[model samples]
Target chain A: MSPQRSEQLLLIPLRLAAMSAAVICFLIVALLVLESLPALNNIGWRLLSDANWRPTPAAADGAFRVTPMVVATLVITAGAVLLAAPLGLASALFCRFYASPSVAVVYRRLVELLAGIPGVIYGFWGLVVLVPLLGAWRPPGASLLAASLVLALMILPTVALISESAMRAVPQRYVRAAAALGLSRWGTIRSVILPSARRGILTAVILATGRAIGETLAVVMVVGNIVRFPSGLMEPVRALTGNIALEMGYASGDHRSALFFSGLVLTGLVMVLVLFANRLGHRGAISDA
Target chain B: MLDRVLTQPRAKCRKVTLPDRLAALLVWTVATLVAGMLLWIVLDLLRHGLPHLSIGFLLDAPRDAGRAGGIAPVLVATAMILIVSLAVAVPLGLATALLLSEYIRRGSRFAGFVRHALEVLAGVPSIVFGLFGNALFVRYFGMGYSVAAGGLTLACMVLPLFVRASEEALRSVPDDFRRAADALGLTRAAAIRSVLLPAALPGILVALVLSTGRALAEAAALLFTSGYVLRVPESLGDSGRTLAVHIYELAMNVPGGESQAYATGVVLLGALLLINLLTALLGRRYGAQVQGVRR
Candidate 1:
């Protein structure tokens, strides 16, 4: 074969690679839209806003409101993230300014290992252990509170890694400026460093939120699979993800389409967070450069 | 002014500074707590899960509706899915990364667009991937709920991670190797194939391990596309359940399956820990080698 031809052949794979992302994106959105159309056409916009999600075979009279699952998802996501951010930020701070280099390195590796563990294992552990610990608050032991704690653990790594990077990126000159004054170590971090790194911290927390909402298996195993809106953190609740996993096995027709619709909602919510994360994260990168 | 802000050691200033110190202490405690939590989870999993694991459990197919049987078939299914996903992701991911790092200029519109798409891909949840895989692989292609469908879905899920990591791997390859290759009259393809790729292999291997861990642990996307059929899969056409999905089914449905779930989780955790250790060793060696070459 001619050299030019060979190069062109090589370019085929390269071009395929370049275009694959776009192809995957279009395929996911298009497939979701097409598959989800049945639910939209049958139930209209109320599928999103209505909480009653009883999926009977009768298409006309079936209730497809998923408000409870939606709320549960939001509550779990917000609650878990609230718990994680402080812990993550603190860990990041300790590593950046306080820990010895040797200690920091090992701790960092531990965090990485934690993050790399499968989501299912987290679910498994929660189901076996964390849930039982919660039996005092909720009889069945599978409550939103347990799920949130597990979710918090699941997201701690992301928060720490991102926050650490952001903290590291703070100009050393600013640190010197703070130190040149009478300010102590704590005061500098509080007054000068954190404010400058505010955007990164927010982005980190948002990315964690994205993970919390998108998580399925862990939340599925612990949150009791109840469809009712959570009355408290101790109450059994079902997130949108748990709902789909619970019913996708036996669901047919409109019930199935409603599951697809749930998937779309999840995809939409995650995309928003991911998009913002990319935007903010890239700007942070540019600023660092 | 900076000194004024700092040197104001008056009572009010001291009170404000006290909160800062307290907050610092509070954060330190929280960080320590997080570390303690990690140790606790690992130890707890080992304590509860280690007892249930036996050689028979590793090799026997689940019995009595996943209550008494070992996870042999589940392991086999996981292995099959892993092979399928890695086969699809490794070569394609390398090429995509090559395209981004070598074939395309970084600041160009197309490159930026692809990067953004990758970020989106990375963050899109597994459940959505499940839904998409179900619609496209299981329904559109009429593949049914089988290993083929689940594998394809997972390939899509981890492809972004592979691309991003491989791109970094490729970029980390020193430019001098390419320059030397060009001086020897080697073409771009030959230079990359013979010189740069070898240098990037360790990093790429790290990427491979990480994505492999991802594929091994995925449950939701596979549940719909692969189905919950719990038997040894004879071919790509056969429906099979991965260990993750198996654990989910047993733990949630079977009455006495919690112990079994813990056993499977131990296996899963062990696999992950092994992969992370492998990556860390490679990462350190790779870092040192790169530094040596640069110097």
Candidate 2:
């Protein structure tokens, strides 16, 4: 066969493959919308606005609002990010500037190991170890605190690795110039590196936040799965993810559609996050150029 | 000015500033604490799981709602699910990646859209994927709850990750190889198949290993689509539990199933560690080869 003909032939399959991603994205949105239509039409915006979620037929109240769960999700995610940011940034700075080459390599490998650990294992560990420890201090160990702590550990690697890369991407000449200016190492890092790497670090934190929001099994296992809003760190609270996973097994009809609606909301939230990250990434690229 | 600046700080530079010292101490403490946490998790799992983790435990089937017995069936289901997901994801991912790196221009709208789609897909939670899978595979397609549905759902979840990694791998192949292929009158397909794929093989393998690790660790995505039936899956149509799901169920629902859950957690962690080691080895090999070429 002619080379051009072969190339044309290959393009058919390649283009089809390339189209798969867009097609899948369209299909997932369409399916979620279609499946959740029943509930959306019935419950309308009340599903999102009200703070109740008693969807089971057995319950005296059949309201299916997710405001409280959404709040719980945000709370745990915020807590995780708050806890992870400092630790992760510090670790990233350590790996990039503080640690010797060998130690950095070993340290990075260990963090990567932490990154690779399955969410369920973290959930398992949190449930068995951390929850009980917290429970010792405050009764009912499986609270927002336990869940946030687990999630913080779960996302720490992402934050640290991304921040390290961001810091690494900063030009060496800038550091040299800061040294030429007689700035101390930390001063240089603070004034030169952090400012240049700020966008990247923010992107890392945003991505970690997105991950914490989407994580289900890990948070589900630890976050006491109570439907009410958490009054404190020690109180049990159910997140959007936990609600769906814990109830999806037995949910039917509107309840099931409501669950799908929850998924839709979760997907929408992450989409915004991904777009934000993409914007930062593109702006950073343009600025660098 | 340069001489003055250098001379002025020459003595001062010898003594680290307080903030520098404090930053060093903070980073060191945090790194140590993080390392210690990892160590504690691994040690705790081993301590709890080692007694229950035996050849028999791996081979036996749960006799009582996972409160008793083992995870042999779960292991089979996990392997089968992984096989199905890889079967779907690898070809699709490789084709999509090739299209991106070789066929499509970098700044084109289509490329951008595809990338954006993938990023969105990657950021979507596994639980949402589970719902998507449950809706499309389990309900729409009439596949019901089966390994095939679960695997296909996992394929959707991992496809973005796999494609992105594979594209990076393909892009890492130096442009010289393409030029050389053209100089030798090699067809595009021939050059890609023989030259590019071979060069990028290690990197692609690393991607595969990493994607596999993610899929293996998933439970939420598989829960609704795969449907947790504990019996050994006789076919792709059979519903079966994965190890992660088994761990989740045993630990959360099944009272007195703590030891079993610990053992399962260990197995899952061990599998992840094994995959990470594979990735490191493959990464080193790829790094060496690329460096050799550069040199």
Query: Model 1 Cα displacement at B100 (Å)?
Result: 0.8
- Check candidate 2 and list the clashing pairs: none
Regions more than 4 Å wrong, model 1: A1-5, A46-51, A138-140, A283-289, B1-17
Span of 10 residues, lowest total lDDT, candidate 1 chain B: B2-11
User: What is candidate 2's lDDT per residue for B1-295, written digit by digit as tens?
Assistant: 2212222223465456787778878989999999999999999999999888889889998878987788999999999999999999999999999999999899999888887777777778899999999899998899999999999999988898899888888999999999999999999999999999999999899889988998999999999999889999999999989999999999899898999999988898888888988888999889999989978
Candidate 1, B207-246: lDDT as tens digits: 8998998898889899999988989999998999998888
What does candidate 2's lDDT look like per residue over A46-100, in tens digits?
Answer: 7876657789532224787788899999999999999999999999887877776
What is the alpha-carbon lDDT of model 2 when measured against the actual structure? 0.87
Off by over 4 Å in 2: A48-51, A57-61, A282-289, B1-15
